[model samples]
Target: MKVKRPGLVTVIVDLNFLNVFLLIVSFFPKSKFIEQFGFYFNPTPSFFGGYN
Candidate 1:
């Protein structure tokens, strides 16, 4: 059996996306748009725990 790891570029891209998302979430913590869509989209309690 063999397992293949993700490519370096893929990992970097994913991290970049995560950073951007966190930035947006942090900036708009109390915005109406975030309140309405963030939970619906992310639905990760821990991800939002720090902000609240």
Candidate 2:
């Protein structure tokens, strides 16, 4: 049997969730913590690119 792939809606929803999460973290004084770990996911192109 072939494995099913995620739909476009699923991919979009996941990205939106991540955006909201990062936005919330950016408001906190300890956002540096998020940045430190976010590097592992290469968030710079999406998150930091928009903010900066």
Candidate 3:
């Protein structure tokens, strides 16, 4: 039997950045959950792609 030791370097990959980020952001009470009261209700497609 044998074992391999981990190197000093490491790599991390995930598909939940937004979810994780939001969770971390939630830790701070100052974070705003959403913009306005009902603006997020009827989300427009343009808003989703507005980042670009």
Candidate 4:
């Protein structure tokens, strides 16, 4: 059996997307949009535990 890895371009794009997502979350940590996004991302209360 053989395992396949993501190509360099895919990895780079994923990292870039992660960076931009983090930037947006950081810039508006207290905004309703972030809160809603976080909830949908992880419905657990601990999702935003540190922020509180």
Candidate 5:
């Protein structure tokens, strides 16, 4: 179902998500931060860079 929110509210939400995504994709401990975002699809450190 589609719900409608005020334009200003939608923009704010999108900006928040973008900021969070950028933080997760940059900096050290990226894996830890991404895991915290509830995105379980990314491979963990053990499975990354062929360590697994």
Candidate 6:
């Protein structure tokens, strides 16, 4: 079976969602997970629809 790779748009969308999730996580002051993955919330809307 041949596995097809996702397009760039799909990858960007996925990353955007991840960034949004991390942003929400940031709401909680006690959340340390986001800190570990720092820099994910720096994405601009022009790049990934503001999910960063």
Best candidate, lDDT:
5
lDDT of 3 by residue, 10-51 (tens): 222243665687566556543346433222333235756763
lDDT of 6: 0.70
Candidate 2 on 12-49: residue-level lDDT in tens? Answer: 99999999987777666445576677533333445546
**Model number with the top TM-score:** 2
Instruction: Give each model's clash number.
Output: 0, 0, 0, 0, 0, 1
Predictions in order: lDDT: 0.71, 0.68, 0.47, 0.70, 0.72, 0.70
Show the colliding residue pairs in model 5.
Answer: none
Q: What would you estimate as the lDDT of candidate 4?
A: 0.70
TM-score of each: 0.43, 0.48, 0.29, 0.45, 0.44, 0.46
For candidate 5, the TM-score is 0.44
How would you encode candidate 1's per-residue C-alpha lDDT over 1-52 as one tens digit per residue? 8977679978999999999997878765556777676443443456656542
Candidate 6 error regions (>4 Å): 1-6, 31-52
- Against the correct fold, how does model 6 do in TM-score? 0.46
Clashing pairs in 6: 45-50
Two-way lDDT contest, 3 vs 6, winner: 6
Candidate 4 residues lying further than 4 Å off, grouped into runs, are: 1-6, 39-52
2, model 6: CA deviation in Å? 19
lDDT measured at residue 37 in model 1 versus the true structure, 0 to 100: 64
